[model samples]
Target: MQSAGNGSEDEAQHYREGQEPPNPIAGITGDVPGTAVQAGAIYGGVHFHSHANDEGAVCQLPLAPAGFTDREGELGRLAQVHAEVGDTRQVRLVVLTGPGGVGKTALATRFLREAMAEFPDGQLYADLAGFAPEEAVEPDETLDAFLRALGVAPGEIPRGLAARSALFRQRTKGRRIAVLLDNALSAAQVRALLPGEGAHLVVVTSRLRLTGLVAHRPRFLDIGPLDAAAAVRLLNGLVAGHRATIGAGTFRDLARLGGNLPLALCAIAGRLVMRPDRSAERMVAELDDERRRLAVLSRHEERPVRAVFDVSYLSLPEEAARLYRLLGLHPGPDFDVRAAAALAGIDYLDAEEHLEYLVAASLLGERGDGRFAFHDLLRIHARERARDDEPAREREAALERLFDYYLRTAVAADLTLNPGRWHLNPMFEDARESPAVFEGRTSALDWLATELPTLRALVLLARDSGRNQAAWQLCEALWMLFSLRKHYGAWTATHQAGLAAAEDLDDPAAQARMLVALAGAHMNLGEVDTATELYRRAHELWVRAGHRLGQAAALENLGVADIVNQDPRSAIARFTAALRIFEEQGEARGVAIMDRRLGEAHRDAGEYDAAIGYLTRAVDYLTTTGDDYMASRALVGLAACYLQAGPLEVADTTLGQALRVSQRAGARMEVARVHQMLGELAQLRGHPRSSREHLQRALSSYTELGAPEAETVRQHLADLESDTGEEHPGEELS
Candidate 1:
């Protein structure tokens, strides 16, 4: 049988006021008429009573606050745990741990008192006094108190701590007693107190994790600071008549000022109710300063807030203090051990130990998933400490390291995001090249998408650091991901930063690239004027650099924008210019792309023969360059032109060629477009069933691709379904 430390609630000064004259403990008789009894049991006093009256009569173990509202979820969890008893499924040990003044004791007491029926033998409660400034009660003393509760003779109690605990456990071995051990010193202190065997359920509450005791197969419940809603509910309930007098705003302000801590909220509510006339608003205004927390709390004649925090903080070791300060420097919402270790310049194992210390001190939180975070108020408190304690240069160094790490990682992610985009100079040159990582194009792209926000933050950080080259390079690396994902807002912002950085560096090539990225966003948004302006500026920059490839890219983009704006003539002129630049540069890829655009402009202008000629040239260039995907698109354009010119045989042959190339290239969008064309051809030939099938396939492909043409394909499919009296196979067009 396991033994417990000899700590008793009777020794704690934080207990309710006044020592009561010895009263009968069993079957509480009518409030003793002005006897002014204490809230919980008074140890070693003349309060003992026998259950000889009948079958185990009701015995009040502790006075838990009634209607302990708003922690309904926690209460339910307690009930669920209590229900786990009696099935030999292992006696459940739940640890409710948190910082001082977070109401761990109160919550445990309430849960145990309400669940007393489930543990009929009796309920044992003790305060380990782990955080008390004075001497803590010994395990032997606490075991003696438990023996006295079990009707053990004073002289008969064993002198040995282990023997006394074993006898105490043996007494309640068969009978289930719910033990609530509060203010636990450490895991070792707690291990001695746990009862042997799986018959008794023990719930230990402490500020520290007590992970050592966790190995005994106890489920841990890490209690954090209460949220605003629960804190306010707890506070309002403590006031006289339990009428919730605090206004919503005042309650919110009080909850926040109390740091959403249950004990603090309780104290504030008690003070407010006692005063009656003083407004919570004025109280909140007074408690704004961290330095004045104690003073402000003392104004209500309740315990000081700073004192409570100090009791928790002063219990920690030196390592925990340093880690707390380092944690205060983190700007992210949560952190992991690796980052914490990096900040402390320590090994991961040492950092984890220090982290547990801070968690014990209530300065840090270990979430259910094992990630760490600080309470918002504690975060603020730590940051304040960091500002006062840590050197500015040191902090800046840490931040820079963090920023650089993210920048390097994000740049690595970019290589996979777009395997096809050929950037002139490598981005993030200072980042160590690790070609062994990223594995494949898909892996890189997935990483980039997942880390996009962090990458964006790093870009901004680089810009803020006056690292203009890094800023521009960061933007460039992310170009393909941003473009393909259609994150136009981020695309625009990053490119704007890149544009300024490029101009600062006086790099015309970088300037052209930035404008091209910006213009892509504008083009996607259908802002032709903005797109044209950016494209023209990019073209000018490229021309100044005499970069034919850059000039061709800009011209092609400009032509596409013009075509989207319905300025077909201007688009044709721009496409022809781009084609000339590409041909001169021997860039077959660029030439093919420009030829396709030129054909589209000519077709839109009703010049079918000219469109066919340009498309044929585009297809030939794409084919020679082995760019079957682009070749397929050019062939589709060729087929459309021939179909418009009434050459059905030529159209059929061109369509077949496009279909084969598109299928081979695995270009789903192009494949869908080919199906759409065939569907239209089938409709013209009066083959309703075939037309419906092709159109439906095209719509399905577009939907899968999330392509803009999905809606149009669905519309065509609906029309074919309607013509064939086939129940409109597609959903309503609108």
Candidate 2:
């Protein structure tokens, strides 16, 4: 380790030498700089083609990309490939990938123009029309053109794919050349075009990853949105000789708001350059109003990013467009085709076709791994269009369908996870049918958690739609995931909305449920007094409605608030009261939960042995109830007692078990407590460095869950840093 660290420092010192000349290939010392025939070399040995044969149909490059806009990075990669094209022995295939209108073609053309000198024999360029108005160019057509370029008679090219590939490879085996396979359909199309055992470089630009070309080991380049600097540079380049009047900050704002997409930026710049009178600030303001920008900017027939999207949208079958809009409602950053289908209320195969159509129009992007995402700004754009174009009634209908989908699915998950638990009221409406039962609870929760944001939106939408029961039922169905995952922000907002709706509808049961959720959020935020008030009101409402279960939950929550307020005596009394009501109602899960709270209050009130006794019972009750997540919480509380009661080794062992249990059940909040206790133990043992690591991990978990304890732990970490004169590496534990 010492030697490795020293070597790393030595390398850093060497790099800091300002006088040293640049060396691109210095790492591979003792070899000739340019002697090796690199991967893309096209050796010249034979060309058996008829010079006079130019029949059959041939396609040229697609209109030179209409002054191809952005793609400096693609251009740079092509430049690198061109630099070593003369010496490369294997085929160097460069894949240019992105959402449409990101200028893949423009970059390819620019590369061909600049790198033409490297390939003396010729540059073979073809437009395969992956997203064309007509049928995609056939492989035979591409091969025939290539064979003709190799001086072979068009008739000599065979019709079979294998035969044509062989002839094409043989013809170009010995020649130094470059092939630009533009808008390819798949890896198969381009793989068939590769010259066998030769030096020719092939650049295959496609919208998809085309994973079939494993042998080529292609250098995959995902063309992400440009950074602010690159976007500005491209804008300046587009409006050549016309200086930008906007300040640097304003220009950057426009670029960011445009999502740094080359096509969008170029269009904005072109407008600015042409108008000359409109200030950049005015355009920025228009872009900031995301709801109307697409409609307003899409007035022009040409240069329509929005129009390109509309064309794709309008062409979609009614079902497909409906699915596309629902997809816009996805809460996660990206999702697969299956989720898209689920959102659209369709089959997987049908969804795949729609995804392909969207990709064709550059409305969505496919990652190398085949997952899809809309550009951040573009996604906001899609959502706006979706909301605007679809009628409000139709939109609400779709949202209801989605909301019920998640609610029903979550109920099924709850049953699968704990088959004996009391069932919440399923929506049971014809419009609220679940798509299908999942394979297991884990799979179900994964989907629900992934779709939580979208689900939350649906809950709010349902409440606004006056579907009061649907709104509250959705919240109850997802309570386990929401509380465990610590999605407090969404949880708090949804319940608040639900509470208002229930009050408007005069549903006491719904109101009680919403109040419990509201109190939990306040408790999680450290608003103890506010939480206590909400919990008390919820308890009263539940009693008025004669809801024993809701009353039990409210009492338990009040106990937690009292514990936070440092009134252990009050906490214990409240917890015991809740426990008796839960037991009387035969609520095993509720009794187990209250036992943990009661144990914690006892521990705080200096009853260590009694605390352990109650906690031990709590663990046993949770096991009996089969509530593994809550069971882990009891274990964590027990571990904390052991730590405070002076059995250091026992506490360490128990905390380890708690951590494992929490991790196995994906209880992030419980896991955070384990870290915090372990950290406190480490500090007691005088291992400040290790203590910091544990504390930092604890802080991250708490922060992620929006736990009330996060700030307390953060301050503790700060104190440690100040005392030890060592800055906290916050993410070191992870």
Candidate 3:
């Protein structure tokens, strides 16, 4: 007998580490019950896959997945297989093979439910777990389970594989029974669990073909993707009347998009039908984004899409399998041999070979343009494997190489569009071979546009994966796209992610730099307070680090925030302080940028002379530095001062120069600003026709830029129409 021990730290530590003292009453089995005594073997690996029947004498087959479909014909065929045994002593065997999540187990379970009438003795079931993420079950372990189910005593069950197989056959001989072995990895596993001679039926399901099962001449069903009609029927059944309002064509589209797979359809259905308020259209709309399709399909934690695909993924060859996961680290949905090579850090031929192996395993799908993709479920599964199976350091290294690939490629592509900007390059310690190179500017732009979605996603990926440097650097490299193309949403999203990564790194310098970038994104988006807070944070970090240059930049960002808030006095103070730092550092470019900002502040405050003087000097400074983009911006400030100071000819000439320079430099937002200034200059001159034209042009450009400045342009256009006796373009002004 053992006495209770007080729960001290020492005793708790042992329990926490799972080394607690053994229970003293584990073997005390003298309690009496009001039922017949039944003793059964419960040896290693011997247990039920499901609950026993009400009588507790037999294990009941588990019900199939809800709304089972497309198996009516197969069930009838399976019944015939059992009938044709016709007095033969050999046990009837059937094998079902299909791709993962194509409902192989579901089909088997449904068949068993229907065939329970034929097996008078009992029905036994086991999930062989061949495709489990950890490892497949061994044949001997399965035999141990069968022995206990047959009422063999724990001590009497044989230890050797052959002896266990012999014992399993002997126990089931001449008995009418049903055995379902699901997710079998090989023929050996199936053969070991079969009875020697009996009116017994054994059914096996696996992803692999398991051709060795052919030696037994068992009945075979090769399941494939459900037909369109059957898939729709299955979806309709699962959605219950929630989809009744949706058209048959739309339902077909949903099923087709699900790749005519039962699991995919069911997963989406599970989400919609369960939520009474969520519409089928809304779910369809959510699945519209291919990048998010898998996430949408896996609506719940318990029924994750990755869980089904992990089994298939874990069953793959090591190289092919690892490549399958590494392929998920790819930035885009599909990839060619070169992209695969880049991802796996292998050569093209080797990548192709590995990819082909994945295709053979049904882990990858080949597409047009010599590219391949995972089923959306498989992609999610593969990524999950990359996170769970691969070590953190391993995934980090692979993603680093991928980042390097994306960075270098983006730089190379940028060079095609703006050759003068080629000098702007990311520093890789040892650059990998190019995944691809650009042929021309159009191709480069197309590739950039094509990769935009993933590039934005990778920014967050780098942040979440603890690669802080890569996160900020990738966003920095995307400055050209944000500045020129003005995908405001992507700009802010990536920068926000970069800021998070930088903060997590706890490096003041990196955090300050990210703060500046993110603040600029917020400024562009017209989020004045948010931008101000971000800049203030940067300023504090820079001050703490004593980085005068970074502090100056942060100060200037804050000045921009003040201007947005209509506080020109505060803006001037910030700009003056920033300009003093720039002057101390002898940074002419910084001085020019801050001086231009000061000029805008003065102009906003109605101080025309000060604005003109500051604007002219800044433009001269920027022009000498060959920064035409900044020069254009300064010239616009000068133009604005000229327009306000009763100098029509000079304002018109300065505006033309600003327009020409900004357009040439591809400074889209600046060009829009110049157009708005030109429109105002025209409006001052009473050229209503020209003013309307210029204002409309400015609005169009602002709209295309996705800049919040579009609202300002819209208001200006409204004023132009109201003053010129012209009705608003589309609607009555509020």
Which number leads on lDDT?
3
**Global CA lDDT computed for model 2:** 0.70
TM-score of 1: 0.67
Off by over 4 Å in 1: 1-73, 87-90, 97-107, 129-145, 148-160, 183-185, 196-199, 206-211, 222-385, 420-425, 428-433, 461-469, 496-512, 540-550, 579-724, 727-734
lDDT of 1 by residue, 1-734 (tens): 11122334542322211122122232233323211122234233323222222434234356776636567677788778788787543567888877776777778888777777777777777777877535455655677777677666675564544445555655555666778877776665565566645457888887766666656777777676777788777777777474436688888888888888776676777678766777777778876776665456646545565566656665556677767876776656676686677777778899899987787656787877666887766766676666776788877776666655555656666544433345755653433355635675456666666556656665666677687887787788886576445565677787888888889999999999999988887776667798989999999999999888898898889888878888899999988888898778776677678878889999989998788788888888788866665677788888888777767767767878888888765556678888888877766655667777888888887776556678888888777656734343442211
In model 3, the clashing pairs are none
Could you give candidate 2's per-residue lDDT for residues 1-734 as a string of tens digits?
A: 01100112222222112122122222232323212212222233323443543443222334454435456666777777666655546777788876656667777776766656666666788877655323457565677788776667655554444445556676667666777888775665676667755566777776655556656777767666777788877776666666445777878887877778777877777777877877878888988887766654564527677855554455445665666677776656777776676666678898899887776545678777667888865676667656877777766665655565566666766555445444336443322355446676577668778767766876787777788877787776677677678687888888888888888888787888888877877877778888889888988898998988787788888888888888999988888888999889987777777878888999999899999988999888776666778788999999989999968888888888888878866788889999998889887766677778899999999987878799889998998887744434442221
Pick by TM-score: 2 or 3, better one: 2
In model 1, what lDDT does residue 407 have? 54
Candidate 2: residue 537 Cα off by (Å): 2.8
Compose the digit string of candidate 3's lDDT tens values, residues 1-734: 22111123342223112242222222223332221111222123222222223453356578867788777787888888888666648788898877787888888898888778778767888887777425666556677777676666665654444445656776677878889998876676677678767788888887766666677889878776788899999988887766456678778878877778787888877776778586667767777776677677766846556566765776677888888888777767776786678777888898899887776556777766677877655776687678777888887778777887777776665554444231212442122234436766457666666677778877888888777777877776676666667787888898888878877877787678777777777788887888899899999999987888888988888888888899999999999999999899887778888889999999999999999889999998777766776788899889878888868889888988898888766677888888788778766666666777777888998898777878888997787667735433443111
Candidate lDDT (C-alpha), each: 0.69, 0.70, 0.73
Quick one: best TM-score, which candidate? 2
Can you give the lDDT of residue 708 in candidate 3? 82
- The parts of candidate 3 lying over 4 Å away from their true place are 1-234, 237-263, 266-323, 331-339, 347-375, 384-396, 407-450, 621-624, 722-734
Clashes of each: 7, 20, 0
